[model samples]
Target: MFSSVVAVCIACFLAYIFNQRSREQAGDKNGKPIPGPPSLPILGNLCDIPKSHSWFRFKEWTDHYGPIVRFKIGASEHVIIAEEKIANDLLRERGSHYSSRVFLPMAAEYLSGNMRPLFMPYNDLWRTSRKLMHRLTMPSMANSYQPAQSIESARLLHDLLQDPRNYERWLQRYSGGLIFRIVYGKRVQTGEENYLQRAIKVVHNVERIASPGSYLVDVLPFLRYVPYPLAPFKQEGMRLHSEELDLFRSLLDDARKELETPDVLKRPSFAQTFLEEQEAIGLTFDQGAYVLGSLFEAGTGTTAAAMMSFLLTMTLHPQWQEFLWAELDAVVGDRMPDFEDIPRLPRVRAVIKEVLRWRPVTAGGAPHTLTKDDEYNGFKFAAGTTFHPVQWAIHLDPVLYPDPDQFDPSRWLDPSFPTYKRPLDKFPTLQNFSAFGFGRRICPGMNIAERSLYILTARIAWACKISKAKDSQGVIIDVPSYDYTSGFNVMPKNFAFNLSPRSKLHEQVVEERYRYANNLIYLKPKL
Candidate 1:
């Protein structure tokens, strides 16, 4: 009878708490400012979220609630800002208060202990990570990687020339090479020799697990306590996480060995740069280690997918293909395209922008968690809600780009083409797009990715004609319908294309470069 009374007392306390929260939400004059979506009793709009693609569903809600919409999930409230104008205000203008990541129950509570800097809240540590990235990879400072980009792009061209069936692999190799080389001062060999590939493959598993609603462990944190025998999936995931740590640890050791050599530090890649800079900044060794790892996560995956998109877009649009070749032939000619040639290739840059816009690397960016209560438009966001602004929706906004679904870079050529560029600025580049990210979360490796993408795409288009293959049935294959792999980082679904030298001279040019590039650097993978 005493225990029963205690249970009733507990129920009464929960009821009292819910009543107070409801009263706060209902708005007496003393209540918090802003509008909110219609909420369910306790669970709120939690039931509506996973019913469809959350990003697409959010697009519909954004239409109803303007740029910033207030919605609830479980007991949490969030503000979704779909409008770029508003995003600019909050993400850029109000960065200090607005930059914090929302507290994800599973991400914060169970999966990682929120060790990842991307999920880390805005604090001294987050500031340290941000400062380290700025110190090492600031826009002016990141040019140290240009030489690496050029060498890797040449190797990428040779790889495509040898075996185009796996163009996707080449793109991944280029991205991995850039980041590993940048941070660790270690070169990732092309073809099979890439040690970084092992690291990449492992890191991708973490990405796959963290994608939207991919695991129930992220939702029901209690499930983590389940025994291994009953929960095989958790066991497998735990095994994968262990393997990832081993992989990262191995790279950290590898970087230390290369550091001893001293001669290998050409551009002072991100790791090398940080080791030197962090001492002045008062960052700890653990901070440096995780900073490098976070750079790896931010570096290779999404940018590689974007490169794959460029190749896919080229395969899909023959007109654009023809146009890029014309520019390549006209500007750079028989010689290879370099950094100087990028500015002259306006349409190529526009195409890159449009492709990223169409199928963004992150369908929505890595979720941003709110730090404190704030009003967005008329909506109120609580301190601990995840905000995932859909890049597809933002890129395809009709008001921003008319007839947005189509892939017409020519629209970008419309001198009045309103991009994120400073108003009236003509030249379009990756810098104009938030494809990297917003505010504090902007990709630190963008400089390396941009230079790599520019050099490699220009070379591929210049040296070869990109066209789809024919199956045994003799029907012309389309690139998009071919195959696509999806997770957080999406890419062409393993599509095949034919690669032949534009001329015998082009072939010789590729071969000659390949021979000299033998000294460039490579590491063959073990199976």
Candidate 2:
């Protein structure tokens, strides 16, 4: 019986491959095939896809094959968009047809139970989730969370002043605490908090499982149907799903309990709003829990990673730090910077924009699946084609950004550069920034992320001096400009750096502000 079953599976796999090949041979009406590297029979481009840092390889392909390139792995076809205008033309101007996501059997099904909005297809459920997220994260609504963000920023300054060696930990705590407060009406006081650690683990797991070629079952979907005991990946996915669900449900339950108390001094949170309007929003309890959980997951690490890149940039290009300090001293004087000061501080804003464009957190753009057949520039693509608007390629395009590898903030500040725009205040802003993403599926948390980046960047520049570390010999240590971790979202690896207060008075102000923030009624308590 087992032999017969094995024989049948092989037959089915062969038949599927043959059918796919036949469809490819039948040319589209236009008969203009997309350009790409050569592929072999049966395996297609499976051997070409790297297990890590695939973005660099994709950029190389774009360089050789023009802006739009196509390759196949197994039966699936993938396209890479390397130019900014073409990405905008398809993913934004024609978003309705290119907004859906590719289906990953492990990450989307077993691990997430189809509840992770990032992996969901462009269907009613995804639409509902996006609508609910927009309610809390839109620009107008995002402003309501500034007080919480300010409180967390104060803590960040204090943490760095106390222990500058663990600057990465402090950044993680700041982003985690702010997101937790906005999502569950709770605060993450330290980096070791149980909830924060668990959430970080969950995010890491999802990124690992969802990465291209991470799991064989993702390409060969039939493997998912094997018996649970025989399939280790299936068992692992199920275990992770249960743990993630428990975490989400527990956080939601705690928020619900807090809302039931009349004298709780209600702090506004996504959890509270969702619980109150879950019925009206047309999502079940589980769906709402995942929506809130998704917010926490998406917002936590990406912001912290970008901030890490900022620190790395400051270390590498200390000249920019002087530019930032000059702006902050002029616009923000002695007090810590806030949102109202953002418009007047163009250099500070420019530094943030340059950091994002220089080392984008998501170097490989998020994949968008074509929901219907489409033609662009006389080339035809069938429905179900996956598109990756490679951020690494577009941001480093030599034509759009001359001397693309150089860390230059002047591109946004000077009229001589092609990227420059007039009225520095509005031009250097993060709105519609390429790093945040494109189209209808652009990051909903962009407003919050931008605000966090601005406040942190400004305050840090005002209070601290960022420089390269010195050894006992008083020699400056070297920091690798391109050394980054391997993941969909990457950060600079731990490097030696010196973060110190600019003056004794600056340290005192950080302490005072932290104390004042602590006294606020909305700042206490944890879920």
Please tell me which predicted candidate would have the highest lDDT against the true structure: 2
lDDT of each: 0.67, 0.86
How many angstroms is residue 154 displaced in model 1 relative to the true structure, after the best TM-score fit? 0.8
Query: Where does candidate 1 have its weakest 10-residue lDDT segment?
Result: 518-527
Give the local distance difference test score of model 1: 0.67
Q: What is the TM-score of each candidate against the true structure?
A: 0.84, 0.95
lDDT of 1 by residue, 1-527 (tens): 56545544554455446544744654423334544468665446666766324666677777676666666653444667676676677676767766787554344433343556766788897887777776666666556567667777778888888888878788888877777776776766653664676677756765666665555444333344555555555566656646655655566656556657756644345555555555786766555666777787777887788878877877777678787878788887888777778888876777787888877877656566656666654445555556666675677688988787778887767756555342323367777367777776677777666766667677777888877889889888766632555566667677767778899888888878777766764332111
* TM-score of candidate 1 against the unseen true structure: 0.84
Best by TM-score: 2
For model 2, the stretches where C-alpha displacement exceeds 4 angstroms are: 1-29, 261-265, 523-527
